[model samples]
Each structure stands twice: as C-alpha cells, then as structure tokens.
Target chain A: MSTQWIAVIGTCAFAFILKFVGHSLPEKWLAHPRIGRINALIPIVLLTALVTINSVTVKTKIVIDHRMAGLGVAIIALYFKLPFPVIVLGAAVGSAIAYHFSH
Target chain B: MSVKRDSFSLSFAVGAYGTAFGAASATAHFSILQTCLLSLLTFSGASQFAVIGVVGAGGSALSAIATASLLGTRNALYGIRMAPILKVKGFKRIVAAQLTIDESTAIATAQDNEKDQITGFWHTGFGVFIFWNIFTLLGALGAQAIGNPSAWGLDAAVPAAFIALVWPRLVDKKTRLIAVGAIALSLVLVPFTPAGLPIITTSLLAIVVGWRA
Candidate 1:
C-alpha cells in the first residue's frame, strides 16, 4: 500500500481509539470530581501550547518576528471582552497589515 | 439545534486555513481530490500541515506520516474528555469520532452546562466540517489565484486564533506564569526539535508547573 494510505489507516485507527475512549467511558468516571478538575486544566495547557507553537517560527537563524503581532492584537481584544469572531477578524487584519508593512 | 448555523460558523472560521492547506497541497502537486479528502478526513490543522510540510520539504512519506501521527496524539486526550458527552452507540460512535477536532472538542468541554456542551459540539463540528471542505475545494481550484500563504501572512492567523481562544480564560497569576514559562520553553526547544514537538513538550512542562503551583 502507498505510504499515504498507510498514514490514513493509522490515523483512522487512532481516531477510533479516541472515539472509543471519549464515547464509551462511563459517566461516573467522566463526572468524577477529579476528572473535572483535570479537564479544566486541559484547555489552559492546550491553548498555551497551541498559541505558542503557532506564533513562533525559525528562519535560518531563530529570530522573533511580527507573526506574533496578531497574537498581541487578539490578546488586547480578549482583554476588552470582544466576541470570538470579532477577535479573530481583528487579529487577522492586524497580522495582514503587519506583514505588509514589515516587508 | 442549529446545525446549519453551526456548520456555517465553523466553515467560516476554519475555511481560510483550509484554503491555505489546499493551496499548499496543490503546490506540492497533490490532486484537488487528495487535498479535499485530506482536509475533510484528517481535519487537524497542525498535523495536516506538518505532513504536507514534510512532503514539500522533500521528506519521505514515512517521515511525513510520523510527523502527522505525532502531532495528532493530542486528539486522544480530547476524546477522553468528550467520551461521556457524545453518548452514542455502535455505528453512531464511529461517525462522532470522525467529527471530533480541536475546536469542537474545546467548545464542548468549555461549556458550563450539559445543554450548551451538546450544542457547542454539534454546531462547531458540523460547521467546521462543512466549511473546511468547501474552502479546501475553493483553495484547490484557485490555487494560483491565492498568493503565497506565507506572503499573505496566513501563518500568523493560527496563533491569533489560539490567543483569542486562550487569553479570555486567564484569570489568575499562576495560569499566566505557567503560560509564560511554557512559551519560553517552547521557543527554546522549537529549534532543536521537529515541527510540532516543541508544543507537546511545552504543554507537558506547563502541566507540571500548573500541578506544582
């Protein structure tokens, strides 16, 4: 089989395992106080990883760039309690403008 | 309740990124069908990009798949959280599993109440699926029409979207400290690791910090 197909199969298997765990687990376990507390922390950690990883890039040498300017704008929007869509648009516009001006 | 609206919102939210992916697939000489199928089926942004990036950079297919698989490991954790809420049986569970992605899982888990969680998952997942596919097709069809994704600064959008998702929840000093420390660690390690490993490593570090603090 082609490697892409093999990858797809592996991904599908992984997805199945995830679904089995998510969909079939007992309610008692899911609602367990400890689980809830741990779940609460999941978002904070996941989002931190997501944001930080997406924001930075390495060129020939590592240098901080304007890519994170959008993240900054989004942070400001969130601080002001803007809606999610609005925050995204504002950040997109900010990043686009920053990219345009930086070059 | 509002499956159509949710689908629309998800598509609109994630469609641009999907389009970028489609464009990249095209640049890599992948067919439109392959691009669309990948977006529709794979659905995880980072993993898909990592796979494609590896291919575009002349890496072997095995390397690309390994990268995708490594990046996708987090979906297992998402599943662990979502298991109880889905409540499907047999065949339905399979379909639901296919639909679960980062945004839908996050929205569902973040909801304060049960009703909201169900709504959030259905709306977000349905929306992202429909829109992601549509934009993937659009991007593939108009690959040349779209400028370089990098030049358009689309790469910045992912972090911007994530910050929008995350920054609102930071209500305390400890969380902020963990976030700062995690970012610093991620930055330090990004150069030394593969594409997405830094995020995973930094997440583990943040979890440790959060556990201790």
Candidate 2:
C-alpha cells in the first residue's frame, strides 16, 4: 500500500480510538469533583489552542487581519451574551469586511 | 424561525468553505470520489488544506501526512474530554471516533446537561457529515462552474467559521488572556516556523497558562 493510503487508514484508526475512549468512560468516573474541575478547564484551553492556531497569521508579519476581525466580532457577541447564530453571523460579517478592506 | 435561521446560516456559512475545498481539490486533480472521501473520512478543514498545500508545494506525501497529523492531534484532546459522555463500548468506539470532529466535539462538550450533550454530539456530527459530504460533492462536480474560489474569498471562510466557533466560548478573563497570549505567540513564531507549527506551540503555551491559572 502507498504512504497516502496508509496515512489515511492510520488517521482513521486513531480517530476511532479517540471516540471510543472519549465517549465510553463511565459518568461516575468522569464526574468526580477533581476530574470535573480538570474537565471544566479543558474546553478553555482547547478552545484557546484551536482559536490561536486557526486565527493567527504569524508569517513575517504580525497583522491581526481578517481572522482577528472575525474573532473580534465573536468576542463582542460573547460579551453581549448573543446567541450562537448571532455570534456566527457577527464573525462572518466581520471577516467579510476585514478581508474586503485588507485585501 | 430560529431553527430555519440556524439551518440556513450554518449551511450557507459551512457550504461556502466546503465549496472552496471542492474547487481546490478539483484544481489539484483530485477526483470527486477522492474529495468526497477526504471530507467524509478526515472531515477536517485545516488538516485537509495542509495536506493539499504540501502536495501542491511538491512536498512528499509523508510530509503532508505529518503536517496533517500534527494539526489533528487536537482531536485527541477532545476525545479525552468526551470519553465519559460517549457510552459506546468495544467496536462501537471505533465508529464513534470516525464521527468525532470539531463541530460535534465542541457542541458535545459545551452543553450543560447530559441529554443535551448527546443530542448535540449526534446532531452536530451527523448534520455536519451529511452537509459537508454533499457540498464537497457539489463543489467537486461543479468546480469549473464555480469559477475562482479565491474570487469569492472562500479561503477566509474556514477561519471565519473557526472564529464563530471560538468566539462564543471566551466568556471569562482567563480564556480571553490565554487566547490573546496564543495569538501573540503565534505571530511571533510564524516567520521562524512552518504554517501549522506555531499553532501547536501556542496551544501548548495556552495549556501551560491554563494549568497555571
């Protein structure tokens, strides 16, 4: 088999393992106070990593650009306690505008 | 109105980027089948783009895979958090893993109640998978008809989607601080590293900050 196929299969397998392990653990074990505290923090950290990686452009320049604009809109939505769709729309509009102006 | 609005908005928003991916894959000579498979199987936009970018840049398949894998590592962390919520055992775990992605995982984790989490996971995962696959096929088949994806600013769609996803979650001082720090660090490292590496580094930094705080 070629490397690409192998990589695909490997990735798929890895994904399966993650899902099974993630969803199968007992609630009692997960809901332990210590565990709950830790889990509560996971979303924040994971979201931070996901957002930074997705939004930031760190190549030769430090410009905030369109992604940041979207993020800014998202932040504003969250601050105002907007609903999910509102947050999404705000960011989309913000990004579209940012891209239009910057480019 | 709310449900219709949600569905329309999500479809339009996600479909815009999905169309871009399809067109790009077509331009790259990927068959509609291949593009569909990638969307259905991998189901990750950034990693898919990274793989294609490396291939387009003439990098080896191994390099492309490595880059994709690095970005995909985040899913594992998502899995760790969702492990208890998903009740599947034995072979079913494998099937569940295939379904887990950014949207489903995020929706599942964000809900305050158990029933909501389950419903969110299934609805988001299944909904995204169906829509993503359908749009990918549409994009691939209509690649030529769609014209230049860049002209539509489709490249910006994924980040926009991500912003929409992340923005609602930053409800506190610590999360906001970590996000700001991660972005700053990513900007500082971009010139010195490859496209996705800065994200990994910044994520680790965020983990440290979170742990410390």
Candidate 3:
C-alpha cells in the first residue's frame, strides 16, 4: 500500500526476473568464464563492503565505537575457529559489554 | 556429517539469525507486520538488511530499493548456477528459484552427483525458508515486547553479526586482500559519496580482481 511496500515487492520480483533470465540464458552464455569469475568475486566484494559500512560508518559519518572492540574480539575468535553462533552472539555480547563499560 | 544433516543444521542456525533481522528492522522503525512481510517476501538476508539500513538512515525509498536490488543480484547468479542441477519446469521452477540462494547453491555444489545436488538444494533451501520465517515472527514480537532495542545494544548486533559472517568467508590471501582493499576504499569514499553508492563501487575492485584471476 505504501511506497516502501511497493519497492519491497519490486525488489522481490527483480530476483525472480534475474533468475528467470539466468534460466533462460543458454549454458554457453552462463558459462562465460568472466561471468563465473565475477560471480565468485561478487560475494567476496559485497561482504567486505558490508563489513566496512556496518562497522565504520553510521549514516554518512565515520565513527569508531564498541562495535570495533567487538570486531577485535571476533577476529580473535575467528582466528581460533569458533563456531558460527558462538562467533555471532559472542561478538554481540562482546560489543554490549564494551558499550556498557565505555558509556 | 551427512549432507542432509549438514543442510538441516546449517539452515536452522543461519535461519535463527533472522532474529537479528527482525530486531534490526524493529530498530529501524519497521512494524511487526512489515518486518515479517520483509522476511517472507524479500527473503534475502543481506538485501533485507540493506533495506532497513537505508530506510532507517532517512534515505529515500528509492535508495533503499536500489541498494536492496543490487545485493539481490547475487541470488540471480546463484540461480544460474543451480538451474541445470535443479532441472525443474513450470511451478517447480518457481520453487527452484525461491530456493536458489547462497547456502543452497553451496550445499548443492558440494554434492558429486545430480541426485544428491538436487537433494542438497531442496533440503537446505526449504529448510532455511521455513525456519527463517518462523524465527522472524518470534523475533519481531520479542523486539516489540522489549521496548527500546538500542538500550539492549541490539544495534551493535548487526555489525557484529556481519563481522562474524564475513570473517569465515575470507579463505585465502586473495580474498583477504580484496576484503581489506574494499574496506579501505569504502571508508575513504563514505564521506564523499552517497550512502548506497560506495557499495556498488566496491564491485569495481571485484571486477578487477576477478578479471585478473
């Protein structure tokens, strides 16, 4: 009913459209090495961009905060190869604790 | 673990993380209804997060749509990779498309044969879909009940969760370099560029790296 909801539906349809295009494309088209290579890199690149935006910038400003501390703890946890839940919730707990202490 | 077991567990764990999305969406001023609808319809975690992130920051609805649509493109790529393996027609194709996501594609690709690949894709995709929606509902209700999400530091959970998600995927020096380079580039561009533009720009780095590879 609202603009946001309309946009949401449009976004949902785009995924199907792109996918249908993919399905419709011949294997030869899909098999282009460049496409495959770029696809692989897409996730890697997007994830990095997300991590940066989430960690460093809030809206339009760059500010450092307890999230970085949690990230620090997470890097350590990741290095030791902790499980996913542990790492995720651990980072949250770590951030919450640091935020509490800092404020 | 067996592939089925792996699929189920992976779906359950990652799907439960929808709770974060529910919480984050709440923090971003989405209603319980809108939030659940987001999970149900958009169904992509990163893109959904981008929507809330953009809208929450006083961005235009167009910007939110642009950012989310860009991220959802990856799902299309996943769809291409899994389509032949899935080999469904008509209504089944719709199911295949819905299930065509990063985890399902990954799990399906891990299998050596067509049968196993199809099995992997269906199990993981539907598993995640079902669990993700359920948890999203629970999470939205919970976030509403909790009152202010920020005081509980649910705001930090997003970035922390993102860090947790990305850290494991940086498997080698090349990916690590791209990660580091993208981060630095985005940081530099953040102040000068619009909110959503920097993300699209980062794909340039991916293009260069991928071209060289």
**Predicted model with the maximum TM-score:** 3
Off by over 4 Å in 1: A1-13, A31-38, A81-92, B1-35, B44-87, B100-128, B139-144, B209-213
Please report the candidate that would top lDDT against the real structure: 3
Candidate 2: list runs displaced more than 4 Å. Answer: A1-13, A23-103, B1-31, B44-93, B100-128, B140-144
| TM per candidate | 0.66, 0.60, 0.88
Task: Count the clashes in each prediction.
Answer: 4, 5, 0
- Pairs in clash, predicted candidate 1: A22-B83, A23-B83, B7-B127, B11-B131
DockQ order, best first, reads 3, 1, 2
lDDT of 3 at A33: 84
Please report, as a residue range, the 10-residue window in candidate 3 chain A with the lowest summed lDDT.
Answer: A19-28
Fraction of the native A-B contacts that model 1 recovers: 0.41
Give TM-scores of chain A for all candidates. 0.70, 0.65, 0.83
lDDT tens readout by residue for model 1, A26-101: 5455545544444455556555765665566542124466667777788888889886556655666677788878
Candidate 2: TM-score of chain A is: 0.65
Q: Per-residue lDDT for B1-213 in model 2, tens only? A: 233334444545554566656655665455676677778777776566555543433334565565556556556556666666876666666656666777777667777788778767666666767777787788788765655443443334444444545565577886677667766775666577655455446546544554554
lDDT of candidate 2?
0.58
Docking model 1 quality class: acceptable
Report the number of the highest-DockQ candidate.
3
Cα displacement (Å) at residue B123, model 1: 6.9
Kindly list the per-residue Cα lDDT of model 1 for residues B68-124, writing each as its tens digit: 555555565566677677676778777677777888887787777888787788778
Evaluation by TM-score, superior candidate among 2 and 3: 3
